[model samples]
Target: MEHVVRLEQVSSQLLAVVRRRAGVRELSKIVPEACGIVWNVVRAQRVAGAGRHVAVYLDDQINLEVGVEVSTPFAGHGEVIGSATPPGLTATTTHYGPYQRLHEAHEAIRQWCASNGYRPAGPNWEMYGHWKDEWNNDPTQIVTDVFYLLVADGSSS
Candidate 1:
């Protein structure tokens, strides 16, 4: 899949998430479960203007947090917890297809970082836009934004 990777600055944002440690294959089940938990919390709290769904991958073991963006931090309860998006320089790209095709967008960002002399400094994440009914008919209409935090000055700490 063709992708356009760009270097951008990201601001820290609040999140309501369900943290889990699962392999890549398990994410298909884990993500939806987490989303369900988070959405219920959002509705109960009556948080207006909640943003898109997000999955923050902290490691290969899939230390993941399935979440939705919130305007401010809140006390977490049960499986749903509060977190913040990492802020700084990042390599970003948008994937326009089904979730299964998301790996291509990640690979594209990795290649962009390598060729551009940047190195991943931290975990990466994906922000999924609001779902559309038409996406069922044309999966390519689905949108997901991928972000990889980059090391400052390309230096290893």
Candidate 2:
């Protein structure tokens, strides 16, 4: 498993709301659909950051968190109707090929963290950098960035 950690500039976003009780199947159903709709109709760009953190957050909602946010940059004016921004400081990685294969990308990060003696922090995120459902006819061309926040020393896994 390869691992990289980096800092990101902070940003803000306006978001549409959706709520779901905690669980992978539930999240899987809700998030992909919401993101797909937002991507196809709204034409939003994918957010960047780490992957593991998002998974941990999904599994553990210690803090209030949003998943797979859709956004546009801040223009210092009234918020655009469909514009949005995700909180920054995420660990991000591009997982190519089918979206289902993203599970491996995430597993790589988790293994990297364990081998390196690092703990994951709060909830992480996944941003769809590119989704060309029409052209590719495969989710492989779909690019997703997953984020996992780091935990302090001696934290729980």
Candidate 3:
């Protein structure tokens, strides 16, 4: 996919998440498991303004936070804890297609950063857009925004 990667500054966001450490190969399984648990908590708590599901990838070993957006930090239940994505400069892009092709957006950002002089700061996340029923008619209409935090100096730390 041709991603229109851009640099921007973002503020922190609160997420009710279940954290885990896993390899890339395990994401397909663990992500859903975590998201499901979080969703149950959000519903039971009636957390307001709960929004799209998010998967935050923290490091090389892949410390992960999978959950939905919450309005504020709350008393967490079990593994569903109050967590936040960092505020900083980032390389971001929007992907329009099926989730399976979402990785292409990440790759696009990585390549853009490499060629344009920037370094990943070890955390990246995917923010899934609210689903549209029409997407079932054309999976290519699905939307996801990908973000990679960048080092302050845009240099490898």
Candidate 4:
């Protein structure tokens, strides 16, 4: 799919996350498990949530912070702890399709970055839109935003 990629400065989005070191291939399984743990903590503590989940990829090894968005930062419950997506200039795109195809959006951002001479400065992330019942039948309704934190040099122009 054609992704409309853009560069923007975004503030950190606070999350209750669980850190995990998984291989690229293990993400599909591990992320959900970690997110569930994060959610459980949110529920158990009655933390106000924003109804969305995010996964922050910290490195090439696929070390990541997977969790749901919370209204405010809170204390850790075992492995689930407070974290946030890094604030910086980023190249981002919104993918409207099934989650399994989110790689396309990430690739689009990478391609855009390469052509535009913007190197990734830090972590990248995916903020998943809230689930809708209709999305079950219409995969196009699913929304996942992909972002790559760009090196904060004056090269974004």
Candidate 5:
């Protein structure tokens, strides 16, 4: 599939995250569980705009933050911790398919960066859209946005 990679500025976002060092095999199990924990906390705390979910990859480990956008930050408790999504210039693309195929989107971004004289400056992340019933039957209906923080000067910082 053709991916349209674009450079855009992402604003800082509040996140409720669970940080862990695990291989790709463990992500399927860990991410969902973390999302559940975050959701429960959001409900209990009555956090507004609690819906969007994010999985941020910090190095080989994953810091999966599942929460909605909030106007302000909140104190973190237990496994649910408060953090800000990386904000700056980012190369982003949307992947339309099952989660298993997300790597293609990442690879496409990497290629786009290299060809355009840019490089990943920091951690990357994936923002998952609201789940729809149709998505269960049609994997292509699922949507995910992948972002890679870009080096300020198009070179290693």
Candidate 6:
């Protein structure tokens, strides 16, 4: 039930931020709160007068030496911050289910990319669309788009 999809070039303006170090155990607790921190900034933008979406891009591996940075101004305590931009190419797909299943969709895209001779460049970010109402529970109604930044032939820029 998975398929390959193309992504039109997109550039997003995001507040800078730095992600704090966390293991799988700590991630379960930190990620949600970090998302909230970012979301609050998104909401405030709406309150001010912007009508665009903001997303956080994470890298697969953190450089313990260099650390990370988020461009988004909103940040959690001790977060490494920088603005996220799309790499030149990406393998994009839509995930229609609860947020919990996002990992499954990501794995599907990752495998697809590998089979097709593409390697992942960074952590894919989910672009949120319309707010979910009761339909959130219905896998058929829920819609989440996943984008994997890709590097063809695994070349480093």
The best candidate in terms of lDDT: 3
What's the distance in Å from true for residue 82, model 1? 1.0
TM-score of 5: 0.91
By summed lDDT, the worst window of 10 consecutive residues in model 1 runs over: 148-157
Q: What is every candidate's alpha-carbon RMSD to the true fold? A: 1.5, 7.1, 1.6, 1.6, 1.8, 5.6
**How high a TM-score does candidate 3 get?**
0.93
- Which residue pairs of candidate 4 clash? none
**Candidate 2 to truth, TM:** 0.56
Q: Write the per-residue lDDT of candidate 1 for residues 23-91, one digit (tens) a residue.
A: 778878888888888999888988876889999998777898888998888578777888988999999
lDDT of 5 by residue, 21-110 (tens): 667888788777777777888789887766578888876445445555555676776777788788899999999999988999999999
TM-scores, one per candidate: 0.95, 0.56, 0.93, 0.94, 0.91, 0.63
lDDT per model, in order?
0.89, 0.47, 0.90, 0.88, 0.81, 0.54
The regions of model 4 sitting more than 4 angstroms off are none
Residue-wise C-alpha lDDT for candidate 3, range 65-100, written one tens digit per residue: 899998878679877899988889999999999887
Q: How far off is residue 120 in model 2, in Å?
A: 0.7
- Sort the predicted structures by lDDT, highest score first: 3, 1, 4, 5, 6, 2
- Model 6 spans > 4 angstroms off: 1-4, 16-18, 25-28, 41-57, 62-82, 152-157
Sort the candidates on TM-score, descending order: 1, 4, 3, 5, 6, 2
Worst 10 residues of 6 by lDDT: 62-71
